[model samples]
Target: MDKEQQIAPSAGQKGEEQHAIDVGTGEHGDGGGGIAGDAAEASENERLALVEEPGKKKSTRVAALDAFRGLTIVLMILVDDAGGAYERMDHSPWNGCTLADFVMPFFLFIVGIAIAFALKRVPKLGATMKKITIRTLKMLFWGLLLQGGYSHAPDDLSYGVDMKKIRWCGILQRIALVYFVVALIEAFTTKVRPTTVRSGPYAIFHAYRWQWLGGFIAFVIYMVTTFSLYVPDWSYVYHIDGDVNDGKQFTIQCGVRGHLDPACNAVGHVDRMVWGINHLYMQPVWIRSKDCTFSSPRTGPLRTDAPSWCLGPFEPEGLLSSISSILSGTIGIHYGHVLIHFKTHKERLKHWLLMGFSLLVLGILLHFTNAIPINKQLYSFSYVCFTAGAAGVVLSAFYILIDVWGFRTPFLFLEWIGMNAMLVFVLAAQAIFPAFVNGWYYDSPGNTLVSWIQKHVFINVWHSQRLGTLLYVIFGEIVFWGVVSGILHKLGIYWKL
Candidate 1:
């Protein structure tokens, strides 16, 4: 009695017992509704006590996810804002590697990770379906708007549009298409149910299965179209039927061929018809059967020039390649979700290391087999595997630092601008900031004020076009990031759409 009575008199004991019993409990003993009430009361009393006995203040900073997102947006801004910085901070050589190449894939993976959290908040069935539809439509409209309306450029949608140089599609267009498809998977597939009082069926929709299937199917279709569709083949149920060119091969070439090809009975005719036009103008950046660019040189009979091939059969957003691009984003989301759910450092590291090795090995295998050549413009399956795999490794590293190590860094500068990444990317792509820089305030000459200044004053700057272009683009990027950061700071604006 003496020992128990003496122990019960401790100050912490009094606070703990006072607050503990009144709090409600779930099966796990985690506090419930009553705990929230108790916490509120405790907070109020603590605040009053603090006021009575003033103490030092503590800092309130953003979370690790916020900082990570901030850093991502900064890199995205830098890469997308590049107007003509193709030499310096641009995507890598077709079959090579570069820093800029990882930016888009990183964005996609982050989107996936983000969706894991977002989908949890959305209600099931009716409301969720509606949300998915609305969000998908909005994404589509936003993508189109970002792609810009009909362009005055030669290949841009007019009746007289040039088949060779059409600006038929772009980044946002690809993003929207992928987001819509991936959204459907996230909404319907990855769902959790409370199976029992103690445990529940943690069913992940296995959306990656669908993603892989679609990617492979698209690759197969593309390969068929590239090799067999264009060539004469007749050992199966499907036949070229009647060869009839309806001017479609050339006209629909720039638009939605992925959806159109299988439906149209006149694919062979259309392909052959466009074969001439695409060869003369569109230039195929890649052909299906060719082992290498050298193996099937343009000088060969009926072969198209590499430069022209670069333009035709595929735009960066060609419907076929678009399939792979969307898959890349979807795959990215998969990696992001895995990082969020995985508990241990060793588990994440093991996963990432295995994935890295797999990608590197697969890339090497493809390089030799000439199966799905690792080309960026085409966004080949192997390229997606290699790049996305590499991105997984990097993302795992980020997850470790932000979620496990609990370290924070200078992110206010980036977070201020990154929250609205899509909006910023579209604006920066249009050179809105660069245009402002070229205005009266900094008006001098040479595209940007920075350039003008560099030319006039910093005359001894580097001679490389890549170097000059890099600095020029970076100048615009800094100015853009700065302007947006200030506006966000003043208004306290952070957005998701």
Candidate 2:
């Protein structure tokens, strides 16, 4: 990674549960999703902050990677903050893919590309592992602070969460976990010196055999556990009224194996046991299912006779699903490795096209055949293939436009946002800045600067509510953050991790 260009990973947007027929955002996650943060995204920022020496700039960082990362952050902000106004920005309901469904996969894929570069030539195992561990911790800290039930942004003034109820899994947490595990595999197996493997089309595969094995292990674990494990009938305490004063207990029946229904999946079972039901993400996307709610794909009143698990919380980024997600990062590493070894541009593009198309076809086959449906919430194997493959194709476009064609002027906005991803996501994407401004009001708590601007300044001015809200999000929020990030980048103020 180039130290000077090194900045925070791009990311944001976590939709819990909001269902209004008029409000158009699709069903999404309980916790936020991450951009593909480089292992170096955090570490390299520290370097650029302190030193900008030419001698330290040993390798040229890929600008396209940064651009792609920025795109993820931008998309997250658009989907998360503006999604309510536009259904197109929303994630899928359950089984199908949508615009929002692509965000997390893109994030993870970029993180993988970064890991390859950051650990291209690890000199010392202890030192590299320590850096990876520390970065992981930092990423988790930010994720927890933003999504671990403490932040009731744009709504509640309270900022404390019960320790027992704090969410244990989320976007950055998953990124941190994937980064740590993938970096470890690369550090352990990657040769101290680069080996020129010019054997054939399978050269890179052979060279990174051990790392591939590591990915294979992760894949095997996710698959075997998902299929073979028995999910027992379990009970979780719930609040019938959503009031702290009163609560209820619900038992979800799932005394079977290989069941992938929204209720009885082994994926949810593993999460229940590992993170504990209360600690997992409480606002699962599945709450919008037809069987659970009066409104499908949107949060509304519960059905007259909702299933036992209708309101049950599940973690999309849980331990087991993450094992499936790891393959995404590893696939990205392959792309990065191609960049490292193959000198010719044609070779890199060729490899990427082959890999990307292959996975896409496989994923489609799996979904159509019902072998594994493409469910983003489940992080299913087929979903992994489709998203990762899509990521490769998207990255290829970025590489061509930004790096190959010298079209930097056009994507300058995204470039700026990508380079200062951390600051933008924290303040704008996560709604932290808006929430902070929401504290004061002339009459009531909701009548603050944030609401005033969105309502009176933007929403009211426009004839249509949906159009007004959409425009406000695009300009008031996204474009505003873009300018802020651009200014900070110009001033050499980069916030990472």
Best by TM-score: 2
Per-residue error for 248 in candidate 2, Å, reads 3.4
Alpha carbon deviation, residue 420, candidate 2 (Å): 1.3
Cα lDDT for residue 47, candidate 1:
35
Q: What tens digits encode model 2's per-residue C-alpha lDDT throughout 313-424? A: 8888898998888898899888878766665556678999899999999999999999999998889999999999999998888877876666877777787777777677
lDDT of 1 by residue, 1-497 (tens): 22112112233223222222111111111111122123455354233321111355211111333444455666665665442344334454345445556665555555554543344233455555565565556656655544433232211213233444334455655655666566556556544422111211222223245544554575666555643433222111111235232232222222222222211212323433443323221323233223224433221232343322221243444455556566676665555444333334564466566766687678668866876566665566677777777766665555456444544344445444544454455456444444454554333344555456556433347766545555655564655564675486577443334
Point out where model 1 deviates above 4 Å.
1-89, 148-166, 190-228, 231-313, 344-346, 410-416, 436-466, 479-483, 486-491
In order of appearance, the predictions have TM-scores of 0.61, 0.86
Q: Going through the candidates in order, what is the number of backbone clashes in each?
A: 8, 3
List per-candidate RMSD values in Å: 12.3, 9.2
